[model samples]
Target: MSYEECVIVDIDGTLAEFDAEAVRQWVLGEEKQWLPFFEHMAQALPGVAVARLVGILSAQQQKIVICSGRPASYQHYTQTWLEQHSIPFDALYLRPDDEDHLADEVVKKRLLQRIREDGYQPWLVIDDRQAVVDFWRAEGLTCLQCAPGDF
Candidate 1:
């Protein structure tokens, strides 16, 4: 597909309900409770409106690419969740396992490079994080913020 036809979307807080409090607690805590955090997120409910919008875009022939700060190590769970929810996506990109310590925007920027290399020219992005939204805009792509992402 041409670059103008591809759209990027985020998983957490965009397509799925994100528990900010749980994430904040985990981030503030010293221990790395990654497994539990991932498990909790795996059961997150889908964002109906956003999912419908994505479906509409897909029906219109826009290539949907699922991109997120979620770790690649838990890709199985992410993929299963997406499949179970019937969210259409042409590709899924997640933060590398070793790069989990990096900020969301940094990780996504690296993923963007990979996406371009894979022959997708993403024209728009749907995300719910302030930093990430800013990053996408800085990179000259239109980004729609689906929710308050100031956390």
Candidate 2:
């Protein structure tokens, strides 16, 4: 397919349910706390109903690219969850494990740039964060801010 047919979507709060409370607890820990929370999230968080959107895009012969702020270390669990939930995706992008401390918007912006540089002419993005949506809009990209209820 061509780059014009590709769209990007976020994971947490968009396509999957995230345990913010658990994440807060994990962040409060002394050290290596994120590890346990990562494990917990991998198994606990549920997938939202993205099949409808996937089907719609599929019918249009468009591509769905998953772009998440999740660390690369969790890529395995994330992929497994997507598979189990039957969420269709043409590509998956995650944050580098070493840069987990960076802001989500910054990381996502960089990722988006990389995607464009890699030849994906994404015209639309579905994200849960208003900041991300705003960023995309500022760059003249179409974006949808997905509310929790919209999932």
Candidate 3:
């Protein structure tokens, strides 16, 4: 088929779930002391559903983006998780800015603008947050509602 059918997925509450509690536990205290807990928390939010759906798209050479508010520090964690588990996605777009420990709407918006300006035309965006969805819709872009494990 044509690229018109390509799929682009988001991370938080979509392709993957965020363990804010666990993350907070790590950050609010000695992170090194909670390394295993952090890993466990991230690992426990598995993406089986998304992975299976992605498998279908992968066979067709479709592009996928695991966009997330979480910083890219977890990029390697996600990358390894998906790759080791046979999950398929063309690229991963973790937040690039680190002005703070958390990502805000402005950061997401800026990234979205940059992605579009760079000539990326995602056929459809699968995201849970409506803010991003609304932004995309305002630009006349297509999108899909997604949840963790709906892969």
Candidate 4:
């Protein structure tokens, strides 16, 4: 017999779009222009749609972990965003204890190592990053790409 595994989600695209206004506020000196571009990268899940998706995933009782390239603080933003949108997920995986840890390739490798060692083997992983799918698959994890409009 086999046990049901968890589901890992990506913040941008897979569920919600990056908050440009939020990111814009952080772009202080040289990064102002890039702020608006964040909007192009993701689509906000419709409020009702997100709630329904959460319902579907919750009914299955699968552990939903959010993995993002953004740092830990972003996780707070994500949580707040969830409340704003009514989306649901269980845990969050991120960088440098909270701020984008995987920016460096070596760090990413180590972070992934930690995730595997932690025993949170996901039944399904959803990500907007194709490279992540490829990498996780190589590590023997099931992954799904968040293609255009993919729920």
lDDT of each: 0.89, 0.75, 0.60, 0.56
In the range 1-151, model 3's lDDT, one tens digit per residue, is 2233346677656666654454555543422333454466456554567667777887877766666555566677767766766667766666764533433455566666655555556777776666667666676668676642211
Q: State which candidate, 1 or 2, has the greater lDDT.
A: 1
List the candidate 1 regions with Cα displacement exceeding 4 Å. 1-4, 27-32
Per-model RMSD to reference:
1.9, 3.5, 5.2, 5.9
Model 3 Cα shift for residue 56 (angstroms): 1.3
lDDT of 2 by residue, 29-122 (tens): 3334666766776675444455567658867888888898788887888899888877888888998887777777888888888787777888
Candidate 2 global CA lDDT score: 0.75
How accurate locally is residue 16 in candidate 3, as Cα lDDT from 0 to 100? 65
Which one wins by TM-score: 3 or 4? Answer: 3
Question: Candidate 3: lDDT of 93?
Answer: 69
How many Å off is the CA of 20 in candidate 4? 11
Worst 10 residues of 3 by lDDT: 26-35
TM-score of every model?
0.92, 0.82, 0.68, 0.64
Candidate 4 lDDT, tens digit per residue, 1-151? 3433677676665576544345545432333333343344333553344346656987788777766655554455557666666666776666565333233233345666656566766766665545566676776777666554211
Ordered by lDDT, highest first, the candidates read: 1, 2, 3, 4
Best by TM-score: 1
- Please list all clashing residue pairs in model 1, or write none if there are none: none
Provide the clashing-pair count of each candidate structure: 0, 0, 2, 6
Query: Cα lDDT of model 3 overall?
Result: 0.60
Error of 2 at 15 (Å): 0.4
